[model samples]
Target: MSNPADPFVEELRAITGAAHVLTDDASTARYVGDWRRNYPGAARAVVRPASTEEVSRVVALCATWGVPVVPQGGNTGLVGGSTPDASSREVVLSLDRMTRVRRVDPLDNSMTLEAGCTVLAAQEAAAAAGRLFPLSLASEGSATVGGVVSTNAGGEQVLRYGNTRDLTLGIEVVLADGRVLDASGALRKDNTGYDLKQLFIGGEGTLGIVTAATFKLHARPDKVVTGWVAVRDPQAAVELLARLGDAVGERVTAFELIGREALAQVLAHGTPGMRDPLAGEHAWAVLFDVSETSALLDPTPAVEDALAGAMEQGLVLDAVLAASGQQAHALWALREHVPEAQRLDGPSIKHDISVAVSRIPEFIAEAGAALEGLLPGIRVVCFGHVGDGNLHYNQSRPPGMSDAAFRAREEAVHDVVHAITARMQGSISAEHGIGRLKQEAFLQYKQPVALELMARIKHALDPENTFNPGRVLPLPVATPRPSSL
Candidate 1:
């Protein structure tokens, strides 16, 4: 399988054109590495397929030569799921050229889109059709639909709308054997059998390449009320969330918990015009939003009532509710700008972990204490979708520390955080898939029975391990480490 022979490369070029087949270092540089730049590798070549047929042909050729194929989408994934390995034995299959909005049926409340369509584009299409495609994320502008589906992404609005899994109705996938599975349909209820599409939803492109998807849509909210509330602690934030959930029911769309450190970073290094919503400094803040259908009652009244109750109960110290759409956007900007702010600060260790909703406060308290004890003065930026009980717990090195010093302690920091997460029966990887970054940890944390089952599924669907071979699941005992190692 040495470079799949020049004839095979010529065939791939014939199928996707010479311009699309990238063999040079510069053209393939972006595709060789993961988003965090922590995992960099070289591929035999990069192939950009503009159609499902082209994808199938490329996959077939790779399968014939026993060459591993890595399916890549937007490449914005936090995990290294889309990055190729150092072996150069695999070909990077990119779906960037397949972007297209095939159809939008407002009456059916569904839309069909190619895998390469960015999440932001899908949202805009839904908006044009007077609906809401609620799967949103900080990287929506760059994350593709296929990548979102593969990772089963959960974002700010997951409280009301759910994750990518819930939003997706059906999918079209190209299996490892080069067979196209057309599972796309508009059926609301299909209890025919196993619901095979689910296997590929969060499979991390290990089982197959998601070519396109049909997503369910919701009625556009006519009135949206966004608010920023400062809380004393994580417990207070959890209590406030329960009260709001009870008060507004399904109207509460987004509930985010922002630690004081996270907020401080944003206010210090974030975009202009961003201001602290509360007067006095607090240890934590909750950014909650509520929305409702146009024909239904205005959601602002309920949001206001919930905040009033929270304030009286001492759960919320101070709060500010958005008066208009512009104000609402401004409120969200604070939450959205956190990652950018953290990036500007320095290289940091991040954990996307989740625990039971009721156990979130405990997990945070214990994990934060443990991490602090291990490394003094480590700036912790903890925030995420509280409704989903997922937190983006990240650590910034203490001031004046060299990058080399911080890099040296990466493993120790991760061990402390992940141990706490495991003890609480929580997940180490929440929204981000178990790519190269967390693959070893995933094996260490997952139960033996669960791991065996995952391996069985992988073997059954991809016997040769031709599709995204090194992602999501751990390698089998017989499989050797990538040669470049």
Candidate 2:
């Protein structure tokens, strides 16, 4: 392993400061792995750049040495893309030190922020300007704006505001050759040339390192109405979404579907004060919210009426409308902690997938049946943004099942779920980028022409693969050389 005294380390220290270049094993350990701790990588050092210029210099230095640069943000990525590989042949480039909100134009409803800014910080900046940065996620507290933009994060508000891609107006990235692309001005419409900024948006730091971004903001909603509605099944949840959209139109901000198993996990393992909002044990539930521009206009009545109509049509089994802001917050807490509760439960396989909004029910039903037949008694903890057709269809070990045994079948479990997803014209990865986790599935499901185009773009931008190698793109299979011995 390279030490602090290595010339390479000295070169990196020259680019950034000595304090910014982490070389000690204890200090660099956290940067070598992912948040989930599922993917463990080894890096000689973790370089933290304080600005775009420093990031450019760091990338340029790495390129000069042919060292792969894995650009990481808040390190909250689930797909293991942010972490380096086990080879210890790479340098982890962290942008955590470059969290500068360069500008915020409330009049333009836009904010230009460095990649290191936490999602929450960006949201607060928008709020301070009397605007809204709607791209939200459970990891917003830790997930950085650059990471979200790279993954093209889609949260509850995606039903209304769309993904990070839609919210991003421009970006400033450091190409593999250490060239700076300063396209960080918010432009509502620019048709003169190719949309170059977008290439690095969801590029997952493969083509280049995203140093900063300019995001489009929105007017802050004056009022929000939240509801917890019990539905018969996924189909009912889909129908209810349609009904709610018809009544409230674009006022529908979020529509999340929670399975009974998912809810039970939360109620069982969640913190105190978290309780079931609705009465009776239903198979499925939906957590939805409607927002209005004027505080005087109460969206509660409209939501209640929609639920009532849905009940009459058998779309809604029962419902609880949040009467106060506290109640609404409590309801959202339940939905957000589903994954945490599952983690407390045990080891399991997780799949972040998406199909058409209309085909979600069918996909869920088919995928569930397929998985059960493959591994009977497997507890399915399925839930997600139903309005956007994305579902975190995760699985847990059955009661008293050996953890070792359950984990041994992860590949088989994923195969069944992914096969069904492919058959239904669904994506193996929805909001989450095809990081190391789903690279194989991505290759399997993505069209040949599409894959070719992606490879072409990667080669065109980073021909030497100086940036995140063996990530979104599948690693080439190794063929044994003719027996030389």
**What local distance difference test score does each model get?**
0.89, 0.89
Per-residue lDDT of model 2, residues 1-485, tens digit only: 84347889899999898999997789998899887789998997899989888988888888899899999999999998999888888899999999889999988889999999999999999999999999889989999988988888899899999999999999998999999998998889999889998898889989888888999999899898898988988999998899899888999999999999999999999999889997788899999889998867877777888888889988888988888899999999999999899999889799999889999999888888888898889999999999999999999997778999999999999999998888888889988888898888898889977777787788889888888998998654222233322
Q: Stretches of candidate 1 above 4 Å error?
A: 1-5, 477-485
lDDT of 1: 0.89
TM-score computed on alpha carbons, candidate 2: 0.96
Off by over 4 Å in 2: 1-4, 476-485
Where's the lowest-lDDT run of ten residues in candidate 2? Answer: 476-485
